[model samples]
Target: MSSVLLFNKPFNVLCQFTDDLGRETLADFIKNPGFYAAGRLDRDSEGLLVLTNDGQLQHQISDPKHKLPKTYWVQVEGQIDSTAIDKLCKGVVLKDGLTKPAQAQATSEPDWLWPRNPPIRERQSIPTSWLKLTITEGRNRQVRRMTAAVGFPTLRLIRTQVGPFKLDGLALGQSQLIKQTNLLK
Candidate 1:
């Protein structure tokens, strides 16, 4: 049977198991062998990172062709307005090309959220707001670029869900083994 691992990767941790620079990595938390990350999160971003022992399952989860929706809770530099939300939903033009339409809405910060180790820098005059954005394509730094293109730069980003899996019940730096049966359904 194949095995899956759900991990709530903390901010500033590398996705890989080893790092020559001695940065914190999956090795710091996960000790199991044969499992590898299905998808990658930037070292600066945090949220649900899926790992699997089966190579076929890894490709199924990480391949963009699957069109699995990834949701993020974004803290932006300004009070994001409807216009920006609409732009995000309508597909913002990026250097790479126009992004696929995304689901976006202004939202309040989650109450269950944990504090970051090194807090995000804040501007006294510029207020920040939260947004819940969902996208099917996982382009490199796509969310950050999209938000910035719409004039609201991301202050902090935390992914909350990916496909059927979620960050629910996992604490920062925590990892849990999930039965394959639970994931396939």
Candidate 2:
């Protein structure tokens, strides 16, 4: 049987086990050996990271061809309107090309959210808003770029779900090992 590790990666922590620059990494949080990350969560982003001991499972989870939907709760620099939400849902033209249509909507800040360390910078004159965005493709800084393309820069991003796994009930910088059979539930 394969093993899966669900990690709630904290901000500024590298997704890999080691970093040449002496930055915080998965090694600092996950002590389990023989497990490798299935996908990457950017260092600046906080959220669920899936790791697996089986190579085939890793490929299935990370491969864009699988089209596993990943969801994020984003805090943008300005109040987002329906127009921006519509654009995000329809597909935003990116430098790489047009992004796949995503599920996006303006949302209220989640009450269960934890405060980010070294809080995001605030501009008193410009109000911020929240968005729930789900995308099936993983591109470098894609979420940030998508929001920027819609005229709202992301100030903070927290991934809440990846496929059937979620960050729910997992605390910051924590890791939980799960039996492969339990993944679908």
Looking at model 2, report the run of 10 residues with the lowest lDDT sum.
Answer: 176-185
lDDT of 2 by residue, 19-109 (tens): 9999999999999999999999999999899999988888889999998999999999999999999999999999999999999989999
The number of residue pairs in model 2 that clash at the backbone is: 0
Question: Which residues of candidate 1, in runs, are more than 4 Å off?
Answer: none
Worst 10 residues of 1 by lDDT: 176-185
lDDT of 1 by residue, 47-71 (tens): 8899999888888889999989999
- Provide the global lDDT of candidate 2 against the true structure: 0.93
| Residue 108 error, candidate 1, Å | 0.4
In model 1, pairs of residues that clash are: none
- Report the Cα lDDT for residue 87, model 1: 98
lDDT of 1 at 179: 65
